[model samples]
Target chain A: MTAQAVISASDLSLTFTTADGPVFALQDINLTVKDGDFVSLIGPSGCGKTTLLRVIADLERASAGTVSVNGMAPEQARKARAYGYVFQAPALYPWRTVEQNVGLPLEIMGTADAAARVKRNLDLVNLGGFEKKFPWQLSGGMQQRVSIARALAVEPKLLLMDEPFGALDEIVRDKLNQQLLELWAATKKTVVFVTHSIPEAVFLSTRIVVMSPRPGRIIDVIETNLPRDRTLDIRETGAFLKIAQRVREGLKAGHSYED
Target chain B: MPVTVVCLAILVAWYIAAVFMNTVVAEAKIEAAGGGLVNTLDISWSLERPVIPAPHQVVVEVWKTVFTVAPWKVKSLVFHVWVTLSSTLLGFALGTLLGIGLAVAIVHSKLLNKSLMPWIIASQTIPILAIAPMVIVVLGSVGLTGIFPKSIISMYLCFFPVTIGMVKGLTSPDPMQLDLMRTYNASGPQVLWKLRFPAAMPFLFTSLKIAIAIALTGAIVGELPTGAQAGIGSRMLAGSYYGQTIQIWAALVAASAVAASLVYGVGGIERVVNARMGVRA
Candidate 1:
C-alpha cells in the first residue's frame, strides 16, 4: 500500500496588512508530506518558511488556497491535537518544573497516566533526570531539549519544528541534530521542519523544499537518497557533499541572498 | 549605613525645626513669667502646644498612649490603630478582588476594554477626598455606618491601582507564549489560569502594595466624613480641634509605621511567590 499523505498544501497564500502596504509572507505554495517522511523547508530570512509552518499548525491563516493535516482542516487537526510543534525558542513556562512542563499538553488534554507519559517522553529526549529543574536553570540547549520532550509527550503522529536549534551554538546544534535523527528513526513519525541552514536540511530531511523571499515560494524540492540510519560523519562523504552542493545551488538559482 | 545615616540626619533636623518653630511662643511665655532665655531651648522642646512638637515629645506621647494605657481603652493608641487597620485591611481585600475581577473582564472582552478602561481612568481624576464624604453620607443613610462606610471609601481609593496593574499584568505574556497556548487549542479560561495568571504574579503583588497603602489613606479620610470616633484618623481630628500638636504628631508617626509594615508584609509574600516560581532573588 502507498504511504498516506500526512500534510498537503495547495496554492496557499498569506498576506500581512501593514501600514506601508500588503506584505506577501507566503504565496502559491504547494507541498505534500507522506507518512514517516522528514521534510525540511529551507531558505533565507523573509522566505516565509516559518510562516508556512505556522499555517500548517493553524497558528497563522492563509490568505487564499487550501491546506490540510491528516485530511482534516487545519483548525480541526489542531483541535484534534493531530500534531506536536516545537518552536524556535524553547517556550517553556518559567514557573513550571521540567517534568511539569513536559506534561503540560497531557494535563490540558486530561489524559490518563500522565506522569508515565511524561516520563517516557523525557527519556526519549535523554532528559529523564532533569525533570525537577526549572527551564531557566537549565542551559539553553538543555532547555530546548526539554521543549522537545514536551512536544513528544503529546504522542502525536506528526511533528512540526521551526528552527528548533537556530539559537544554539554549532557544537550543541550538531549534538541535537544527531539526537533528533535518532529520535525520528525510533518514533517513525512524519516531520515538517523549517530552517535556514543548508547542511542541517541536507543531513536531517528525507526531502528538502528550497524556497526564496519576495512573495515567498518554493524553488526546488530535492529528494535525498542518503541512508536513514546515518551519522554526522556522512557530512564528510562525497555523496553528502553532492547533495549539500545541490541545495546551495538551488538557493543561488532563486536569488536567496543568504550571504 | 546610608539608610541609618539618613534617619539620624532627619531626626536632628526635626529637633532643630521644633526649637526654631516654638521660639516665638516660648520667648513670649518666658518674658511674661519674668524668666530669662536661659531655659528657652528646654521649654521650646516641652511646650504646652508647640507648632511642631519635638521628636522625643512625640515618642513619649506614643509610649504613653500605646504602652501605658490598656489596649481596648479609648485613650490607647493601640485601640485607635486597630480600628483603622481593620477597615483598611477589609477595604484592601475587597478592592483587590474588585480590581482583579474588572481586569479579567477587561482583558477578555474587547468591548468591555474599550468601554470601561477610559471611564476607570477618568474616575481617578475626581479627587477621592471630594468623593469620600458623599460615599460616607450615602452609605450612612442606608444604615451602613461604622467600618462599612469607611471601608467603602477606602475601596474607592485603592481599586484604581489594582485594576491598572492587573490589566497590564494579565496582558504581560509575550506574543509567542500566547501563540503557544493557541496552538494547544486551549480554551480562554484554560489560557488564563495556566499562562496569563501565573505570568501576572509579580505585577499583582506590586499593585497590592500600592493598593494597601492607598487604602490606609482612604480609611483616614473616611473617618472625617463618617465621624468615626475610635480610629487613628479620629484621634488626629480630635487633636486638631483641641490644638494638641503632640497627639497629632504621635498619630502621624503611628500611621506611617503601619503603612511601612503593610508594604513590607506584601513584599514578603511576593518574595515567597517568586522563590516558588524559581525566580532568582
Candidate 2:
C-alpha cells in the first residue's frame, strides 16, 4: 500500500529582519513526509534545518510558501495538539519531578488520568522508577529522555525533534538513536528529526534531506535502501556505510553549491 | 557559624556593660550632696539615664507594663505591641498585593515594562521615613484614620524587592523550554500558569521574607508621628519623654522577635510548596 503524506511543505521560505538587513533563513524548501516515515534533516551551521523544523512545528512562521500537517495548516495542527516536539536540550522544568514534567503537556491539554499517561510515557522512554527525581538531579542523557517522555505523553501523531541528541556523547547518542528507532517502530508514528551528523542521519532516517546555508535551501533527498529491521550491527554493514558516504557527498555538494 | 557565635558574644558583652553603667550612675547619684547636685568626679562613662538600658531592667518594665498596667494607662507595653502588629500586618498584606500585581503586569506587558520599570525603580529612591509623616498628614486630613496610613507606609517599603524578584523569576525560562512550549501551541496564560508561576516561586518566597521585615520597619516609622495611640514606635516616643529607657528597649526587643517569627513562618511555607512541586532543593 502506498504511504499517505503526513506533512507537506511547498516553496517554504523564512526571512528575518536584522540590523544588518533582511536575512533569508530558508528558501524554496519543499518536502513531503509520509505517515510512519523516519525523515532526517541534515546540514551545516546556519543552514536553517532547525528553522525548517520550527516552521513545520509552528513554533516559527514561514515568510513565504505553504505547509500542511495532517491535512491542516501548521498552526491548526498545533492547536489540535497533533505534534510532539523535542528541542536540542531536555527543557524539563527544573522545579518539577520527572513524572510531573512528563505530565505537563497532558495537564495543559486537560487530559484526564494524567498520572496513568505519565507512567506509560515514562515506561516508553525507559525512565521508570525515576518519577520522583528532579531535572537537575538527572544526567544530561536522562534529562533528554525525560523531555522525550514529556512529549510522548500527549501521544501526538507527528514527532518533531531538533538535534535532540546532539548534546550527548557518541555512546549515549548511538544508544538513544537505537531507542528512538525502536520507539518509532512500536508506535508507528511519523518522525521529522534534525541533526548535523551524517552518520546519525543515515543510521536513523528512511530518507535524508540535505540542505545548504547562506539562504538555506534543500539540495538533495536521498533514500535508504536498507532493510527496515535495523540494530547496532546494521551500522557496521556495507549498506549503511554506502548510505552514510552518499549523505557526506550530498553535504559536500551543499557546501560547494552555497559557495 | 563562627560569625553568629561572635555576634552573640558581643551582644552578651553589651548587655553586661549596660547593667554596669546603670549601677555606676545610681551610685554616683547617691554620693551627691545637694538634692539636684551633679557628681562631677564620678564621670566614668555614667549618664544620669543611659540611652541603652540594662536588659533585665527592660524585661522587668516590659512585664509590668504588659501585665499590671491597664489598657487605658499611658505606659502599657501590650497596648503598644498590639498597635504595631496591627499596622505591620495590614501594611504587609497591601504591599504583597501591590508587589504581586506589578510583577504580573510587568511580566505580561512589554509596553508597561518599557514605561513603568524606570518609575518603579525611582519610587524606591525616595526614603520611606521622609515619606511617612507626609503620608500620615495628607491621609489624616482626608478623614483616613487608623490602618490606612500605616499600611501605606508598609507598602512603600515592601514592594520593591518583591517586584525585582518576581520579574527575574518570570523571565528565567531557558530558550529550549520556551521553544518546546511554543511548539505545543500553549496559550500565553497557559505558559504563565504552568511555567512562569512555578518558576517564580522560590524567588517569591525570598522576596516575601524581605518584604515582611520592611513592613515591620514601616509600621514603627508610621507610629513615630501624629502620636499613635498604640504601637512600639509610640511606646518609644513615650519612653524618651519620661526617660523610661527600659520601656523603649523592651519594645525594640519585641519588634525584633515578631519580625524574626514572621520571616520563619514564610520559610516554613516555602519548604512545603517546593516539596509539592518536586523542587525539594
Candidate 3:
C-alpha cells in the first residue's frame, strides 16, 4: 500500500451549543490517513470518534482547525463526491428498495446508467438478490450490507465509516468485518473506520487510533505489524491475539484517562 | 373477522328497527281510512299523502331522478349530484396543491414554519357552515359564481389534515439518514426531491383521502344559499321545501357514495405509485 496521506486533520476542535452550556466534543485533534490504509478510531462512548468522522465527511463543521481530503477542503471534497460514509445505524431509506437506495448517490451525482454499478456493488457485498427488498424487511446485518453497497456504488476515493457495525451482534459483526476487509482489499480505497471494539479494531485496521473522552482527543496511534493478507484463519493466529491485546490495553488506558 | 362481523350485524339490526318504525307509521295511516283528510289523535294527514314510503319508494324516486329526468329539471337528483361532485373535485385539487406547497415550504425553511404554522391551525378554528353563505354572497357579487365559492369552502376544510400529515412525513427521516444525505453533499432541492418527497407519499395519500371527504362536505354546504341550478345540496333544500324526506335522504346517500368512491380512487392511485416505486404497502 502507498504511504501518501489521503486525509489530514490539523488541530481540529468542535463545540456544540446545548441548553446547559457549550459542550466541547473534541479538542486539538490531528491525524492523517494514508491512501489504501485501513485505519480504525477506537474510543469510549461519547468520546467524539463519530464526531470526528462526521467532520471529515463534512456532515458537521469543526469549531476550530482545518481538515482536508485529497488536498481539498471538506466541503469541496464533499461536492466532488470524493468519499462515502456509513453511519452507526444502517440508515437506509425505508421507502426505497435496496437497489434504489444503493443507486441514490449516483442519482444525486447525476451519473448515467447506474443500474450496473448498483448490481456490481451488491455483488461485492454478497447482497445480489436482495435488491428488491425494503429496509424493514431485511435483518440488521443484511440492512447494513445494503448500506455498505450503497456507499460502494459511488466508487468513492475514501470510505468513512462511523461505527458502521456497532449495532450488530458479535457473530454478524465479525462476518461483516471480514467481508468489509475483503471488499476494501479488492477496491484498494482509503478507509477510516470507527469502532469501540478492540478485537474488531485489531482485526480490520492497519492502524488503531485510541481516543479518550471528556474533551475527546486521540491518546495513541498503534501500527499493526501483522500481514495484510488477513483471512478468517489469520484471525485465530497468535499475531491477531497479540494485536488485539495491544488494542485492549490502549483502550483501557484511554478509557481510564490515566496517561 | 371478529369485531367487523359483530359491527355489521349490529348495523343490520338497526336498519331492521328503522324499517319496523316505518311500517308502524304505514299501518297507522291505513287504520285512519282513505278520507280526503284523516286524523289519528293530534296527528293528521291528507289523502294526497301516501303511507310512510318503504325503502323501495326512495330507490324508485332515485332511479326516476337519475334516468327519466334530466339534471336541469327541478326534480332531478342527478343534476344536483353532478353539481356537488364537480365543486368537490375542483376544491379537492386546489386544497391538495396548497397543502403540499405549504408543507414543502415549512419543511424547507424554519422561518416559514415559525411564521405560518400557527395561523394555519387557527384558520381551521372557524366553522365552514357559518362562513358558507358569506362566501357565496361575496363571490357571487364579483361574478365569480358557479364552482368557485363552493370550491373555496372545500379548500378550507381539506387543507388542514393534509398540511399536518405532510409536515410530519417530510421531517420523519432518521437523523442518521439525514447525515448520510449530508455526507453525499446533496443540495437542498436534491434532498427534498429524493428523500423528503418520496418519504412523504404515504402520509400525503392518507391525508388526501380525508381531504376528499371534507371537500364533498364543503360542496354540499355551499349549495345551501344562492338557489343553485343543480347539486346534491340544492336537491336537499328543494326536498325539504316539499317535505320529501325520502328524496332528501336519497340525495344524502348519493353524496356519501360519491365521497367514498373518490377516496377509494385516490387510494388506488397511491397504491399504484408506491408499487412502482418498489415500496411494499
Candidate 4:
C-alpha cells in the first residue's frame, strides 16, 4: 500500500575534525526518499547538501545516528552497487575516449554485454556517434553529458548527483535541466540532486529539501504541485513561481542571502 | 634553427679553447725547431698529444676507428660501443622493472613507505662512482663477469629516479576519482590496473628517460677501475695511459651520442604510448 523507501535517514550527523576545530559538516538530518521520487537537496554553499549525498553514497561516514539505502546499511548498499553518483565535475578520464570512459565501470565489474550497455547508455544521453572522441575534444557541457552517460551505463538502482550543472552557463544549464527531467520521466529512477539554484530545484524535483549552513541542516521541504510532464515554460507559471517563492523564503529564513 | 646556432657557437668556443690551450706547446716546439715558418692553427690542431684535442681531430679519430676497421675487432670504436651498449640496455630493463615493483609495494604498504623511501634517497647520495668499482670487483671475484656485473651497477644507479617518479604517479589520482572507483565495488587490482597504472604513464615515461641516461653512465663507470678489456671506458683509459688525447675525446663523444640516442628512444616510446592512451597533443 505504501511506496518503498529507497533512502531513509534519522538524526544523521557528520563532524570533520580540522586543525582549527571539529567542523560540524552535517547535523540532525532526517529524510526519506521513496521509490521513483525525484528529490532535490537545495542550499547555498556550505549547506551540507553535497555532504548528505556523499553520506548516502557511503563516501563519507556519519558520526551519529543511522541511514539506510534500499533498507540496507549505506556501506552494504555501496558494496552492492546500489547507486550511481555524478560529481560536480565531469571526472572523465582524459586518456580514455568517450566510449571507453562510459564503459569503465562495466570493464571494472567484468560485466558481460558491456559494449551493448555502453552503447545503450550513450544513446540514452543522446550521445550517439561521438564514441571515439576524447573527453578533451568535447565542450564542458558535452563532457558533463559523457559523465552522465558513464553513470547510467552501470544501470544502478539510485542516482545521486551533486551540482552536476553548477559550472555550466545559464542557457546550457537550462537545456541540461530539461534533458534531465525527460531522462527522469523515462527511466523512473529515484534521483537525489544537490544544487544551489532555486529554479533548477523547482523545475526538476518533485520535492525540494531546502538547507542552511552553520551546522549544515535542512530548513524546509517544499512539495512541488506541478504537472508530471513539466517544461521550462512552467518557470513562468503561477504554480512554479509560488513554489520558487517559498523555497526563496525558506532560504532567506536560514539567512543564506547574507554575504 | 636556434638550437643549431647555439651548437655552432659551442663548437667555435671549443675550438678557441683548444687553440688557446695548445698555443704554448706549439710555440715551444716551433722555437725548438729553430723558429721555422709554420701556421699556428695547423701546429696546435695537429699536435701529437694536445691537452684538449680540437673537435675536428676527435671526429677524425672516431671516423678512422669506427669506419675503417672490422666492427668485431678490438681496435674499432664500434666494438667498444657494442660492449657498453649491451650492459646499458640490460641494466635499464632490470632497473625499470625493479623501480616499478618497489614503487607499487611502497604505495600499497605503509610499512614499506616508511622504511624504504628514506633509504632510496640515501642510496643515491653514496656516489655511484665510488660504488661502481666495488660492485664490479665483488661480482668479478664470484666469476660474474661480462654484461651482468656491469648491468647490476647500472641498475643500482638508475632505479632511484624511476621509483620516486612512479610513487608520485601511482598516487596522482585525486581523492574524488578514487572514490568513484570505490562506489563501483571494483576490486583492488581493478582499481590499480584501470586507474593507477594508466594514470602513471606520463610519470613512467619521464622516469624512463632519466633512468636510461643514468643507466649508460653507470655502465661506463662500472667498466672503470676493473681494467675491462673492452667498452668506451676502457678505450678512454687506454688512451689516457698512452697520452692519446684525441682517442679520449673521441670516446667521450661516442658516450654522449649513446646517451642522446637512448633518451630520444625513450621519448619515441612515450609518444606512441600517449597516442594510444588518447592523450591530447
Candidate 5:
C-alpha cells in the first residue's frame, strides 16, 4: 500500500507531425509517481514537460508506450474522475461566476453536492468571499487561485499542475507556493507539477524529474533528502543548494545546441 | 444629442437636393413655354411632382399619414409599417434559428464547413431583387401568398450574418479552454450550451443587429414583386405610379424608423442578457 504508484509510464513517446516535419515531442519517457509524493517535472521550453502532463491527464496520447493512472488507462482514469488538472492559465469561463466556474466539473459529473464542493474548494484556496465575482472582476493572481479551487473542487486523489503559478508575479508565486504546499499536506494528494524555475522545482518537490529538450526524455530523477515539514526558507540551506546544483547540472548536460 | 444633429444635417441636405432635382422639371416646363433662365431661379421648393420630395413636404406627408389618418386604414403609414414589421419579425426569428443551426453544424462538422459555407456566400451574390419576382410568383403559384413569401425573402437576407458571426463566436474559445472542457469529460451538448454558446453572445448580438435591418429590407423587396396591397413597399410603389414623390419619401422615412426600433429591440435584449451573464459592455 505504501509503494502504490498513482501514475506509471514506461517507454512513453509522442510525435507530432507538423507542416515542417514530424516533431518528436516525447521520447522514451519513463517515470513512476507514488501515492502522496510531490513530483516536479522541470525542463526547458521544448522539453515536453507540459506535453507529458497533458498525456497523463488524457488530453494527449502517447505514440509508443503504455501509461497508467490509478491502475487504469489514462482515458479510463479521466472518465472515472481520478485526477484534477490545473493548467498554466486560469482558463476560467468569463461568463460564469467564480462559484459556477468552480462547480463546472461537478455539474458535468452530475454530482449532487456541487454547492458544498464549490464552497469548500473556494475556502481551501482562501477565495471564500470572491465566489460571487466573475473571472474578469478578479485580478490575475486571484483568477489563478479560482482555477486552483476549480481543480480541487472534485477532491480527486491525484492533482496534476502544469506551471500553475508560472504566470504570476514573484511575490504572488511565493505566496501560492506556500499555500500549495499546505494544501498538499492537508489533502496528501499525489501531486505532479511542471515548472521551469529552479527554486520552484527544488522547494516544492519530494522527487524531481529533470528533463531535456530535443525529442524530450528524462535525464535525472533526484530524490530530495530535505524534511517533509519544509518551508520556502529551506531553499537557503546547504542541503537544498546541493540538490539545486545537481538539477542545474542535469539541465545543462541535457541541453544540446545542434538540435 | 449628436444623433439628432446628424439627422438634422441629413434633412437639410435632403431638402437642398430636393430643390435642385425638382428645378429640372420647372426649367423644362419654362423652356417649353418660352421662359427658361429667368424662371429657373423662381422654381418652386414645393412642386406637385418633384423628383426628390422636399424634406418638410415629406415630413408633412408622414405626419398626415401617421397621426391624421386612422391607424387601421389602408392609407395610414402605421398600417403599412405594421405589415412590413410583422413579416420582418417573422423572417428574423426564422433566420436566427436557421443561422444558429447552420453555424453549429459548420463549427462541428468539417463536411459542412467545406460544403455549405461557399454556397451560403454564393447565395448572397445572386441578387435577391432579381429573384424576388420569381420567388413571389412561384410561392404564389403554390398558393402560399401574403406574408410567407415576404418572410422567406427576409430569412434569406438575415441568415448569412448570423451564420458567419456565430461560426466566429462558437470557435472563440482557445485551445486551453477546450482542453479544460475535455478534462471535465463534458459531452458535446454540455460544451456547446455551457461554453461555446455563452462565448458567442457578443458576436451573436452584433449579427442580430445586422440581420434585423436586412430582414426589414427583405420584407420590403418581397412586397415589390407581388404588387402588395399592404406594407411600406406597396405604398412606395403606389406613390411611384401616381407620381406622388412625397408619399414615397414618407414611406421611406417610416420604414427606416421601423428598422431602427427593431435594432433597438435586439440591443435591449442584448443588454439584459449580457448583464445576467456578468458580461460588461
Candidate 6:
C-alpha cells in the first residue's frame, strides 16, 4: 500500500466484433498492481486473462474505460519502452542466434551498450553459454528461456508474460518456475503473468486474480502471505497451502456461475 | 556424380535424335541433286547443312566459335553472350527492386493488395514473347534500341515471380510473432526491415532463382524479332537464315549454359548468406 501502483485498470472492457456477433472478451475489469508486485491472472480458457494482460501490453485495444501502465496509457507506455512482453510461444527468429534474438529490442530501440546488457540477461535466465545456438537447435524450454532473456534484455521496469511455460513438460516447467522466481527477486521488476495452472499462480504470485469465462470478468482476488525469499520447497508450507486452497475454492466458485 | 550421369545420358539421347532427324534432310538433298534415293545408313553422318546437326558437329561449331575466334571480336560467341548477359543482369536488378517495393506496398495496405495483385498477375498471362515485338517497335519509335528495349522485356518477365513470392514471404510471420513486434512499439519501417524482410529471405532467394532464368528468356526474345547485330538471339537468327543447324544448336547450348550459371551463382550466394544468418535450411 505504501508503493505507487504500476498498473491500474478501472472499469476496463473490450469487445471483439466477429462474424457471429460482438463477443465481450473483457468486462468491468478493475485491478491495481503496485510497484515490484507479481500479479498472476488465473482462469480457464477463453476467460480473458490473456486478453487482460494484452490490454496492459497494448497488444489489444480496450473498447471502454481507463487503464494505465507505469502512470501512462498502455500505448504511451509501450512507445516509451516501459515494459517487456513474453509471448506464449518462444517466438524467436530462426535466422538469429540466441544473443541476436535477445538483442532485437535493443537494436530496434537503438540502445547503446547492447552487448553487455544482452550478456547479463542471458546469464540471468541461466542460458549463459547458449548464445551461439539458434532457437530451433535448443529444446522448447530452453527456447522459452531465450525468449525471457530477450524480454529482460530491454531492462524494462514491467514484464508481461502470457503462459510462457504452458508448452513445456512438467519437469522443465518446475525448474523454470524456480528460476523465474529467482530472476524476479533479483530484478524486482513488476510482473503481470497470465496462466491456467493453479499451482503456478500460487507458487509465483504476490496476488492472484481469478477470472470466469463467457463475457469474462474477475471473480476473486487472493493475496498471498508467503515469504518473499521462498523457494520451490515452500510449496509444501502451510502458508502456501492455504493460498492454494483459497485459489482452488475461487476456481470452483467460478464454475457454479458457468451455466 | 549423379549430375554428371544425367548430363551424359541427355547427350547420348540428343545424338541419337539428331541422327534420326537429319536422315530426312540428307535423303532429300540426294534426291534433289539427281542422285538415286539414298538409304538411311548411306546418308552421311556429317553434312555441310542438315535439318538437325549431329551432336559432334554442334560441339565442333561451339569450340570453333568460342575458342578459335578472338573473344573481343563481334563474330565470337563470347561477344554475343556478353551482350545478352549485360541486358539480363541489368533487367534482373531493376525487376528485383521493383518487385520488393511493390510487395512491401501490397503487404502494408489492404487497398493495394486487392487492387494491384490481380492486375500484376493478369499481365503475365499475356505472354512475354507476344509482347516483345510490340515493345521493341514502340521503343524503336522513341529511339530506344539495342539493349534498352531488350532489358525492358527482361524486366517485364523478371518482376512477376519476385512480386508474388515476396508478398508471400513478407506475410509469412505468424500472428504471435507479429504481436511480439507490435509489443515493442516498432515503427512500420522498423517492423519491415527487422522482421518481415529477414523472414522473407528464403522465399525471396527462391523466387530470384526463377526470375533470373525468365529474365534471360526475355532478353533472348527481345533480340529475336529485332535481328540485333550482337547477342545469342541474333546468332540463332543468322544461323536459321543460312540453314546452318550447327550454329543454331551451338547458340542454344551457350544460352542454356548462361542460364545454368546464373541460377548456380544465386544459389551459391544464398548458401553463404543463410550460413551467416544461422539458418540451417
TM-score of each prediction: 0.97, 0.91, 0.90, 0.97, 0.96, 0.95
* Per-residue lDDT of model 2, residues A52-136, tens digit only: 9989888889989999999999999988989999989888888788998998888788899999999998999899999988888
Off by over 4 Å in 2: A256-259, B1-4, B12-48, B63-74, B141-143
Expressed as tens digits, the lDDT of each residue in A1-259 for candidate 4 is 5889999999999999999999898999999999988999998788899999999999999999899999999999999889999999998888899999999998987889999999998998889999999998999999999999899988987999999999999999999999999999999899999999989999999899999997899889988868889888989999999999999999889974446
The top-ranked prediction according to TM-score is: 1
DockQ, 0 to 1 scale, candidate 2: 0.69
lDDT of 5 by residue, A1-259 (tens): 6779999999999999999999999999899999999999999999999999999999999999999999999999998889999999999999899999999999999999999999999999999999889999998999999999999988899999999999999999998999999999998999999999999989999999999988899999999967888898998999999999999999999999776
Q: Is candidate 1 or candidate 4 better by TM-score?
A: 1
Please tell me which predicted candidate would have the highest DockQ against the true structure: 5
Q: Which sections of candidate 4 miss by over 4 Å? A: A256-259, B32-38
Candidate 1 lDDT, B1-281, residue by residue in tens: 99999999999999888878898777877666666555676788889799999999999999999999999999999999999999999999999999999999999999999999999999889988799989888887888888888888788878899999999999999987888787788889889999999999989998999999999999999987556789989999999999999999999999999999999999999999999998866
RMSDs, each prediction? 1.6, 3.5, 3.7, 1.6, 2.2, 2.3
For model 2, how does the per-residue alpha-carbon lDDT over B1-281 read when each residue is reduced to its tens digit?
Answer: 99999978977887667655654556645455432323332332244357556555666776887789996566777677777788888889888889888988998999999998999999989987788899999999999999789989999899888999999988987777777777777889999988888888989999999999989999999988778877888888877888877767888888898899889998999999988877746
Candidate 4, which CAPRI tier? medium
DockQ values for all predictions?
A: 0.76, 0.69, 0.69, 0.79, 0.81, 0.79
**lDDT (CA) per prediction:** 0.92, 0.86, 0.85, 0.92, 0.92, 0.90
Single out the weakest 10-residue window by summed lDDT for candidate 6 chain A.
Answer: A250-259
What lDDT is reached at residue B21 by model 4? 93
What DockQ does candidate 4 score?
Answer: 0.79
Each candidate's fnat: 0.59, 0.85, 0.77, 0.74, 0.77, 0.79
CAPRI-style quality class for the chain A–B interface of candidate 3: medium
Proportion of native contacts in model 3?
A: 0.77
- Candidate 3: stretches off by over 4 Å: A257-259, B1-31, B34-54, B70-74
Question: Model 1 residue B137 lDDT?
Answer: 86
Which ten residues in a row are the worst by lDDT in model 6 chain B? Answer: B36-45
Candidate 6, pairs of clashing residues? none
Candidate achieving higher lDDT, 2 or 3:
2
> In candidate 4, how many Å is residue A54 off?
0.6
